[model samples]
Target: MSALPASRDDASPLSARAGLRVALPIVVLIAAIVAWDLVVRLNQIPPYVLPGPLLVASTLIQDWPVLFGSLLTTLWTTLEGFVAAAVGGIALALLFNQSRLLEYSLFPYAVVLQVTPVIAIAPLLLIYLPQETAVIVCAWIVAFFPVLSNTTLGLNSVDRNLTGLFRLYGASRWQTLLRLKLPAALPYILGGLRIAGGLSLIGAVVAEIAAGSAGAGSGLAYRIAESGYRLNIPRMFAALLLLSTAGIVIYLLLALLSHLLLRRWHESALGKDN
Candidate 1:
C-alpha cells in the first residue's frame, strides 16, 4: 500500500487537546449530575431539602420570567460597577504614575476601601444612598483596587532602558505614556479586569442580599434570599445556578477579549505548542 494520509487527530495535536479540554468538563459535569440524581433517589431525599438537578432545571424553567428579570437587574448593576472601576482605576493609576505625591496621598484610601468588607459597608451605603446606587457602589468598591494596583504595576514595569530611549528620542511625557507605558501595561490591565469582572458580580450579590433583608430589591441575590425565607429550596437553587452561570460567562468573555487583544504579541496569550 502507498503511504496513508495522516488522520485529523494525528495532524493536529492542538485540536485534539482543545477537544479534550472541552469534552472533559462536559463529561465531569454529566457525571456529577448523574451521581447527584442517584444519591437523591437512593437516599429518598426530599426535594425541598436537596432538589435533584432535574428538579432544579424544571424549577428554573417554571420561574424563568421572574428569575430572568432579577438576573438582568443584577447584570446591569455589575456592568455599571465594572465600567466605573475600569475607567476610574485606570485614570487614577495614570495620575499616580505621573505624580508620586498624589499616589502617596490617595493610594492608602484605595487600600482601605479594598480591605474593608463590602458586606459591612453595604448596610451603611444602603442607609445613605438609594438602593440601586448603593449596590453599584459596592460593586465598584470591590472591583476598583485590582485595576488600580495592576495598572500601576504594569506602568512601573516598563523597561528602564526603553524609558531612557524614549527620553533620548525627545518623547514628551504624553508620548511616553501613550506609546510605551500603556502598551507595556496592557496585559496587566486585562488581567486585573478579568478579576474585577467576577468580583463586581460578587459585590452586587452581597449588596443585593443586604438590600433584600430590608425587602427592597429584585436582583437574583434578592430572589435567592426571598426563596430561602419561603423555604422554596428548588427556586433558591435555581437562582443560585443562574448567578453562577452569569459569573462564569462574564469571566469567560473577559478572558476571550484579553486573548483576542493580546494574542498577536503577548506571551501569556500564546498556546503552549506555540
Candidate 2:
C-alpha cells in the first residue's frame, strides 16, 4: 500500500512538471504579445516605426507568395552548406583520427577558420565567387568546425580498456574504427550536427545580407534588407518572423532526428522519461 502511494505521488509530480514546462512558455508569450499591443496603441507608435503584431501577421499572410519563395532560396543555401559541413568535417575528423601528423598540422587551421568571423569573409567570397556559391560557402565555413572538433573529441575519447581489448584480440585498425570508435562517437557527432544546423542558417543569412547591398539575391535575408530600405516595418517584422520560424523548425527537426537515433541506446535520449 505504501509503495503504491509513493509511486503515484512521484509520477503525479513528474507529469505536472512536464505540463508546466510546455505551458509556461506559451503563457509568457501570450502575455508579452498583449503588453506589446497595449503599449503600441497607448503610445500611438506609427506603423512605419513599429507595426503591432497583428499587422505583422496580416502582412505575412498578404506577402506569403514572395516571402515563401525567398525562404526557399535561403533554405536551399542552408541545406547545401549543412551537407558540405557534415561531410567535410566528419571526413577530416576521421582522417585526423587515423593520423596524428595530419591532426597536428590541420587542427590549427580548423581553429583559425572557426575563430575568423564569416561576416568578414562573406564580402570577399562574394567578390570572387558567384553570390549563391558565396552564401553556401559562408554557411559551410560557420558550421564546419563544430562537427570536426566534436567528432575528433568523440573519436579520441574511446575507453582505454575497450581499446586495449580490441588490440588484444588483434583487431585491425579499420575494424576497430568501424566497430568501436564510430558508435562511441555518435552522440558527439549528433550534438555537433545540431549546432551546425542552426549555424548554417545563420551563415547563409549573413552572406545574403552582404549580398543584398548589390541587389543580387532573393533570399529572406535579402528581403529583410529590401524592406528596411523601403521602411516597410510590417514586412520587415513579417520576414523576420518567417526566418525565425524556419530556424526553429530546423533545430527541432535535427533534435528529433538526434533523439530518434539515440533513443534505444544513449543515456541522453533515455533519461527524458525520468
Candidate 3:
C-alpha cells in the first residue's frame, strides 16, 4: 500500500512543474514592462529616444504587415545559416576526431576565424559576394564556432573504459564510435545546437544591419535602419520587438527539441522520476 501511494505520487504529471516554469517568466516580464512604462511616463522621455511599452505594443500591432514580412525574411536567413553551421561544424568535428594531423593543421584557423568579428568581415563579403550572400555568410561565421568546438569536445569525451571494452570485444572503429561514443556525445551536441540557434539569429541581424546601411536589404534589421533614417521611432521599436521575439522563439524551439530527444536517458532532461 505504501509502495502504491509512492508510485502514484511519482506518477503525477509534470504539468505543475511546467506551469511554474512558464508562469514565473511571464510574471517577471509583466512587472518589467509595467516598470518600463512608469519610467517613461514619470520622466517624460521623448518617444524618439525611448518609446514606452504601450506605444511599442501599439506600434507592433499597427505595423504588423511590414514588420511581419521583414520578420519572415530574417527568420529564413537565420534558418539557412543555422543549417549550414550545423552541417559544417559536425562534419568537420568528425574529421578532426578521426585525424590528429588534420586537427592540428585546421583547428587554429577555426579559432582565429571565430575570434575575428563578423561585422568587420561583412563589408568585404558584400564587395566580393552579392548582398544576400554576404549576409548569409556573416550569419554562418558567428554561429559556426560554438557548434564546432562543442561537437569536438563531445566526440573526444567518450569513456576510455568503454572504448577498451569495445576493443576487447573486437569491435571495429566505426562500430565502437557509432554504438558507444556517439550516444554519449548526443547531449553535448544538442547543447551546442541550442547555442547555435540564437547565435545564428544574431549573426543574421548584424549582417543585415551592415547590409541595410549599404542600401540593399529587406530584413527586420534593415527595417530598423530604415526606420531610424526616416525618424519612424515607433516602427523601429516594433521591428526590434519582433527580432527579440524571434530570437526567443528560436531558443525555445531548440531547447524543446533538446529536451524531447534527451528526456528518456540524459540526466539534464530527466525530471524528477515518475
Candidate 4:
C-alpha cells in the first residue's frame, strides 16, 4: 500500500507575502522622500518655490495646532457626508429593489446626479446653501452613487436556486432579504463603502477649495488654498501631505473592516491561494 502526502492549512507563506507588500511600499515611500530631499538641496531651490521634505516635516510640526484643527473640521464634514451617503444610498437601493416602478422612475435622476461634475455644481450650491452645508452636500453627492449601484447589483445577484428555496419555504420578502439577500450582498456593499470613503474626502476637499477661506473656513483644503495664496509652499506641502495621509488612512480602515467582516465566508477576502 502507498501513502499519499498530507496537505497543511498553514497561511504563513501568504502572511509573509502580505508583510512584504506592506513593507515594500513603505520602503519605496521613504526612498522617494529621501530622493526629493536630495534634489531640493542639490539644486538649492527656494523654499517658496519648493520646500524639501525636512522643511515640510518641520512646518507640519510647527503648524500642528492649526493643521490639526482644520483636519478635525474636515474629518467631521467627511463623516457627516459619508453617513448621509451610506444611509441614503442603501435605503434608496432597498426601496428600488422592492419596487421596479420606483427604480425605473428615480434611477435616471440618480445617474444624472452622479454624472454631473461636482466642481461645476459647487458654485451653484454655494449660491444656494450655507458653505458648510454645501460642502457636506458635495461630499454626499460624490459618495452616494457607488453605494447605490453596488448595493443594487448585490441585491440582484442572489442565486436563483437559493431564492427559489427560500420561496419554497414560504419565506416573506423581508425575511428573505434580511436573511439571504443582505448576507450574500455584504461583500459588494463593503467594496462600495471603501470606494465611497475616499470619494467623500475628495468631494469635501473640492468644495472647500472652491469655497475658499471666506468666513471660518477651517479645513485642510482651505489651509492649502490659504498657504498657496501666501506663497507658503512648505505649509502647502505639509497640508497636502496631511490630506493624502488622511485619505490613505480612511481607505485602509475601510479595507480592514471589509476584510474582517468577509474573511470567513467570502472568497475575495480569503487569504490568497487559500
**lDDT (Cα, tens digit) per residue for candidate 3, span 1-274:** 2322233665544555566679989999999999999999999999998899889889999888889999999999999999999988888888899899999999999999899988898878878998887878888888888899999999899988988999999999799778987788889888889999999999999989887767468899999999999888988988988899899999999999999999898889865664
lDDT of 4 by residue, 1-274 (tens): 0232333666555556667779989999999999999999999999999899999999999999999999999999998999899999989999999999999999999999999999999888988999999999999999999999999999999999999999999999999989999998889899899999999998999899889967468999999999999999999999999999999999999999998998889999775568
Cα lDDT over the full model 2: 0.93
In model 4, where is the ten-residue run with the lowest total lDDT? 1-10
Give every collision pair in model 2: none
Give candidate 3's whole-model lDDT: 0.88
Please give the lDDT score at residue 111 for candidate 3: 97
Best by lDDT: 1
List the lowest-lDDT window of 10 residues for candidate 2: 1-10
In model 4, what are the clashing residue pairs, if there are any? none
lDDT-based ranking, best first? 1, 2, 4, 3
| TM, every model | 0.95, 0.94, 0.89, 0.93
lDDT of 2 by residue, 61-142 (tens): 9999999999999999999999999999999999999999999999999999999999999999999998889999999999
The Cα RMSD of model 3 versus the native structure comes to 4.5
Error of 1 at 233 (Å): 0.7
Show pairs that collide, candidate 1: none
For model 1, what is the alpha-carbon lDDT of residue 212? 81
Cα TM-score of candidate 4 = 0.93
The true-versus-predicted C-alpha distance at residue 77 of model 4, in Å, is 0.5
Model 1 poorest ten-residue lDDT run: 1-10
